[model samples]
Target: MTIRFRPSEPTDAAALLRVWRRAVDGTHHFLSAQDRVAIDPLVADYVGSTALRIAEKDGEVVAFMGVTGQNVDSLFIDPAAHGSGIGRSLVDEVARPTTVEVNEQNEGAVAFYKRLGFEVTSRSETDEDGRPYPLLHMRRD
Candidate 1:
């Protein structure tokens, strides 16, 4: 499959949300039931507010990344498309990304970032909203 990247449009919101939900449901084993409920609305808000550059394959949005300043605010790939190098392309497209926050419980994601030369620079005991899920602050080195 050939994957391409493009700036997201307003009409892409619904597809982006679907990709987010599918990705989180498939990978977020660490989120509690309550945290899951709380994060959905947060995700919805993010979908509308962030400028996303999306990865499309076969004319369908399969992944996306949100960058704000030097931070990678979000990167979610369709669960079915995991291992396809789309995420790597998104990161590469950024001239130089210095920081990213990752859920500490997601081993695959932690390893993925590490493979791309990011190392944990700090840790948070809870997520941004004070949820119990821990986070690792990573920096490209």
Candidate 2:
């Protein structure tokens, strides 16, 4: 599939949240079941407010990255499109050479970021919201 990216629009919020939830559910095995349940309803709100770039494949949003200045606040690929280069492409389109915080427990994501030339710059014992999930801060090399 030929993936392309465009700035997100107000109407894309719902679909973006769907893609985000799918990606999170598929990859966030470190999140407890209760965490998933608690987080689900917040997805739409977050997507609606973020400055995002949408990754489209065949005219459908297959992934998205939320960016602010040079920082990537969030990146999610539809579970159906995992391993299809969507995540990397979104990062390239929106936040290549940028900074990001990845969950340290998500080994695949850490490796993926490394493959894209991001190196660990620091780490935090809790997430931005003080969640228990540790975060690895990285910057492109």
Candidate 3:
């Protein structure tokens, strides 16, 4: 699989949205169907920012991410493409120290972040749906 990361352009919106929905489904936990209806617009808005990233595999977009708060906001990979290092590439490309929040229930993600050198700075609550989410701030370690 040929994987590459690039800044998002306005013309990339539709493909990016498809990647968002797929990346959400891969986890099969965070983004419920209702969550898409409610949160997609927020994703759309996040994409409008200058920090969005699109991950392409074999000439097709397989993942995407948004960086904010000096951290990665949304990082999603196609369910079929997990473990491909695309996610880590998104984080590796992070220009500064950053943080990522992993739902306490998502052990895999928590481990992934830890393996990638993110430390547990604190746990946080997510306002997106008013849930108590755990957060980890990751810097080069």
Q: Could you give the candidate ranking by TM-score, starting with the highest?
A: 1, 2, 3
For residues 3-104, could you state the per-residue lDDT of candidate 3 as single tens digits?
777888887877777877776665637545675587788777666655578888888888887777667777777778888888888888776677766666
Runs of candidate 2 with Cα error greater than 4 angstroms are: 94-97
5-80 per-residue lDDT for model 2 (tens digits): 7889889998998898888888899998888888877888888877688889888998988888788888888878
**Residue 111, candidate 3: how far off, in angstroms?**
1.6
Task: List model 1 lDDT by residue over 7-126, tens digit each.
Answer: 988788889999999999999988888878878887888887778999999899999999987788899999899998999989877667479999999988999999999999999998
TM-score of 3: 0.80
Ten-residue region with minimum lDDT total, candidate 1: 89-98
What is residue 107's positional error in candidate 1, in angstroms? 0.9
The segments of candidate 3 whose C-alpha lies over 4 angstroms from its true place after superposition are: 28-33, 48-50, 125-129, 132-141
Range of the 10 consecutive residues with the lowest summed lDDT in candidate 2: 88-97
Question: What are the per-model numbers of colliding residue pairs?
Answer: 0, 0, 0
Q: Please, what is the TM-score per model?
A: 0.95, 0.90, 0.80
Question: Judged by TM-score relative to the true structure, which candidate is superior, 1 or 3?
Answer: 1
lDDT of each: 0.89, 0.86, 0.72
> By TM-score, how accurate is candidate 2?
0.90
Q: Pick the lDDT winner.
A: 1
